[model samples]
Target: MDWLGLLAFGDTGWGDELLYGLGITLGLSLATFPIAILLSFLIHWAKASKHRPVRIAAHAYTTVFKTLPEILTLLILYYQSQAVVNWLTGWIVPGSSLSVSPFLAGLIALSLVISAYGSEVVRAALNAIGKGQTEAAQSLGLSPFNTFRKVILPQLWRHAIPGFGNLWVILLKDTSLVSIIALSDLVHVATLAINTTREPFFFYLVIGAIYIVLVVLSTRLQKTLEQRASKGITRMEVSDA
Candidate 1:
């Protein structure tokens, strides 16, 4: 087996296709993360809301998503979401065709699934900050929004980092599920390469290594951010002392 030629960067090998797939995988994960985090925060707030309906809805959202297998959720979103969109488009635009791309469907599915767990992470972090901090901020005449933006969020990251970091790694690996929908992400491309070259072990090993490298890199970045967030807290404490 001419390994070098097989893994070459151009049209001669699977390298370019693999790289393209890697790009898609990374892009999908990156795009999904912020949306997930935002939804997590929103859901957390809803869970804590005074309104009974809001809390029930938020609880149901978390319960359903967390209970469902991620792959099943992805499959449902990929097909059913398109059906919903088609129905809406048919009603609104008459003859126009509308469909959800695999990427979009994957994003929505991953975001919902991850956010269900992430909401709890957010709730925990907020609880760790305690009601005292909010009371203190309010006593100082800080508006609710300003109190959260200026006081709570800065410290929230300190507590939330580890949980969010774990979620990020989970999200990264979950990106592989998109391949099942023919998204042509890293795993899908690797499968394609294996089909043509008749080298399953080699392609799967390559993708595994790629995913491991990404996870390692993400872990290091998370550590760096954690240190930075903690340092800010340390400085504040020292100043108070």
Candidate 2:
């Protein structure tokens, strides 16, 4: 079969399998993103709290996750979480068996690492907001929640866009790690195809191309979001006149 024919969607080729694996890669990354964002915000809030213990606990959360290797964390969560869950289920309902789906385990593990890094970005964004902005909102009779939503979040997002863009690109590539647990993501299927066809060069090159395409598209989307967030904000450009 010719090189092109090998990528054909007909029964003679592996296109369908590759497409399905790509779908899983995209789905997993998208599903994990919002969870990571929420987790980061919660961690940042804890760190920002007036309570001393809350701040300490939040720091510890980021410290431990950020210090550990991501793959090791995933491996532990993938295997150990099931045992932990089954133990609880056994006590709650006799003979009940509980299992953590590989997808869920991967998502949780990725989110932990992502959120640990993301929390710093969020905290930095929060700190970038001027204290006078909050005071102004209060003087205008806006409640604390209203001040956060209206006066703070918009500016926070503007500062956060660049950091988040980097995180997202990293997250997309990181989804390939799920293949280690046999999730059949893009890299996994490409490896399977190579094994069957004995065309490792062609298949692996295809995998690299797919990743490049994803990152290129993501970068474009990130630029658009950055522009939208920066709308009406003025910057002083210094040039040799």
Candidate 3:
């Protein structure tokens, strides 16, 4: 079959399978990003905590995740988490069997890895916002949470958008790693198609194009967000002049 025929949208072609795989890839990334952001905030808060132990623990978490290869993290989580889950299940219930799905394993592994880097991004953004804003809010009788929500958060995104945008692109590409664990992501689907059709170059090139397209779209969205985040500041500065 020609390349066009191979990619046709029907059972006779691998188009449907590839499209399904693309959905999984996108789904995994979208699910993992929010979890990573939440973890990043917690980790950043821990790092800034007054307690030494909390800071130390957060440091260790980031160090271990950042140092390890993402693929190794995925492998360990895929296999070891099942063992841990089974042990807990057996202890809780006399007879129970539980297994970790590749999707869950990948989600957790990717979240941890991304959050390690993301925490640093959060810290930097918070630092950029400066303590003066918080103090000013406090002077106005705003609660700490209210200060963060109203005063700090509005400015935080302007600084963080670029760093987190880069991480999002990285996370999108990293979704391909889950294919190794048989998660049936885009890359995995391409691999399966290649194996069946013996057209390695063509299938791999197609997936590469797909990844490039995703990255391009993500970058454009990031720029739009950055512009929106800066809009108020730009107007304020102009008014000051």
Residues 1-241, candidate 3: write the lDDT tens digits: 5889999998879999999999999999999999999999999999999999999999999999999999999999999999999999999996997999999999999999999999999999999989999999999999999999999988999999999999999999999999999999999999999999999999999999999999999999999999999999999999999
- Give lDDT per model, in order: 0.95, 0.91, 0.96
From the highest TM-score down, the ranking of the candidates is 3, 1, 2
Cα lDDT tens digits, model 1, 11-89, are 8898899999999999999999999999999999999999999999999999999999999999998999999998999
Query: Of the pair 2 and 3, which is ahead by lDDT?
Result: 3
C-alpha RMSD in Å of predicted model 1 compared with the true structure? 1.3
**Counting only residues 3 or more apart in sequence or on different chains, how many pairs clash (N, Cα, C under 3 Å) in candidate 2?**
0
- What are the RMSD figures for all models against the true structure? 1.3, 2.9, 0.8
- Whole-model alpha-carbon lDDT for candidate 3: 0.96
Q: Which structure is stronger by lDDT: 1 or 2? A: 1
Predicted structure with the largest TM-score when compared to the true one: 3
- Backbone clashes in each candidate structure, one number apiece? 0, 0, 0
Query: Candidate 1: TM-score?
Result: 0.97
lDDT of 2 by residue, 1-241 (tens): 4878778896888899999999999999999999999999999999989999999999999999999988889999999999999999999999998989888999999999999999999988888887899999999999999999999998999999888889988999998888899998999999888888899899899989999999999999999998877765744223322
What TM-score against the true fold does each predicted structure earn? Answer: 0.97, 0.93, 0.98
Model 1 regions more than 4 Å off: 236-241
